[model samples]
Target: MKRLRLAAPLAAAVVALLPGTAQADVTYPDPQPITGQEIIHDPTVIRLKNGGYVSYSTGGVIGARTSKDRVHWDDAGNAFAEPPEWWYEYNDTGDPWAPDISYRDGRYWLYYAVSSWGTNHSAIGVATSRTGLPGTWTDQGKVFTSETTDTWNAIDPAVIRADGRLWMAFGSYWTGIRMVELNPRTGKAAEDATVHHLATRPDAPYAVEGPEIVKHGRYYYLFASYDACCSGVNSTYKIKVGRSTDIEGPYVDSTGKPLLEGGGDLVLEGHGRYIGTGGQSVFEDRGKDWLAYHYYDAEDDGTPKLGLNRLHWTKTGWPEVF
Candidate 1:
């Protein structure tokens, strides 16, 4: 999720950055060149109302940065400065991961995950702000959570507004992605609602997480990361996608394979010095689409860095990153 698809800073030859494809292909492409403030994981960016850009990512305190041109960046500081009092209830280490940011109803809503790695003990929480700047957010407490007894883990929260309602899609390593209805007035799960199961691998390792949904034309596309991550150069993380008519989807790939059965079309993979590229968000700015994610820099000994690229819709209606 991001700001309204309206005005944004213009770059030279935006069309050249997004090459058109008449047909979808099996192979993925490389990201565009970017420098400055590279270290980021599970990054989400949103354009400020004043035309600047702000980004948040996983860290001990939720790392943040600001960019006037969307290329050169400066550290803006963390949302909490110190961990919130309630964070200790979910994560003793006080670390957060995979934050989702969006503008809505006169405030910026940030949803993030709290849990130890490789465990179902987790919680999804939210913070709200009027300016979206650092140290301004007010913690709204846990939106959702899970325990060892649950079939799904509550992490990697990706919220989107669709069908006259706010929906949050999240889960990791237990079953796959799950969605629940959120009250538009409070940004919390609605009372007496059914949780919708979205996607899963279902095989050994069952590697699927980081679900993001975007609507284009007649279809709503679901994008997710597959395989292991945080293994340095050995990481096998890649991005895949599927589409559906409804937000709560029986999503299918180009070959009509159901996402519920481990079906997805390849969107991006590691190339050259970039390795383990996954955890993505999509947004449109100034009539052009962009894909944002993180990649481990093989040349820099697996340090995660920000990666951005122009996204184009093929004549076949599938998205390709250029």
Candidate 2:
């Protein structure tokens, strides 16, 4: 039960007094306390066409949860009743991480990864479903992969349609984040596509992963997690972002420092009982933009759980969650 502890009455009163469009320097509030089926990591959410919200996460067979009101979630099932037959060939664990869910052309596309830790030997795969419900997906096979010789780890798959073409951004703790073009028709890596290097931390530890990209207004914003993760309450994970006028970025932070040189604007960080707030996904739902991610609950001895917060755009075009 390591949920966020906000004074409900005080929070309500604060909201009641707030004016439209909070100040650009406003601090992000803690996530609303949610109950039931909370264990999740690397979560990505989608608003169903019928209005119910569903989230997919990293877990055995890809974790799935649903919510009717976006505040109370219930475990639905795993996206796969059984791991896809090819998963074992990449990693014997039969688990997938950091699923990116998107809908296009009347179908739902889910991209995920299978790999062991501390290695570049990994693969990104895709599945499509007419209905995004659990067990309905048809495995679309490998979109891309990397070997030990490569400088990048091919995991943490995130897809977006930019400039009328499907593109994917992925990588972790090696050469930083990288991007590639996808076959618009198949949602797989496009033939003859070139990989484009995106952001990286040139400093020690160089820990960056869980990239989610969104195009807002005239800029493409790259959101990524920084620092160490998976260490329970000791994890130092936090979310950071940068923006570029073009999808293929020379992304820069609020100070105008380039992300290629380790610059990023802080978005959210742990405070009080919430720790390691990272692994995020952004989407527009019910007329409001939302950020969905997982945070380690310090009160629960560092168990990870799903967290959601409304996102707002600043006057200068930066995105903030409060």
What are the per-model numbers of colliding residue pairs?
0, 0
Model 2 regions lying over 4 Å from their true place:
1-28
Tens digit of per-residue lDDT, candidate 2, span 1-322: 0111112232321223246754333234788678888999999999888788889999869989998888889998899989888888788778788899999999999999999878788999999998887889999899999889988888999999998998999989886889999998999886567989888998755688989899889999999998888999998998899999999998888878888899898888787777999989998886788888888999999999988877777777887665
Return the lDDT, model 1, position 100: 91
**Model 1: runs farther than 4 Å from truth?**
1-28
**For candidate 2, what is the TM-score?**
0.91
Q: lDDT tens digits, residues 200-299, model 1?
A: 9868557899988888888888888888888888888888899999999988898888888988987777767889988888766777878899999899
lDDT scores in order: 0.82, 0.84
Q: Indicate the residue-level lDDT of 16 in model 2.
A: 31
Residue 250, model 2: lDDT of 87
TM-score of each: 0.90, 0.91
* Best model per lDDT: 2
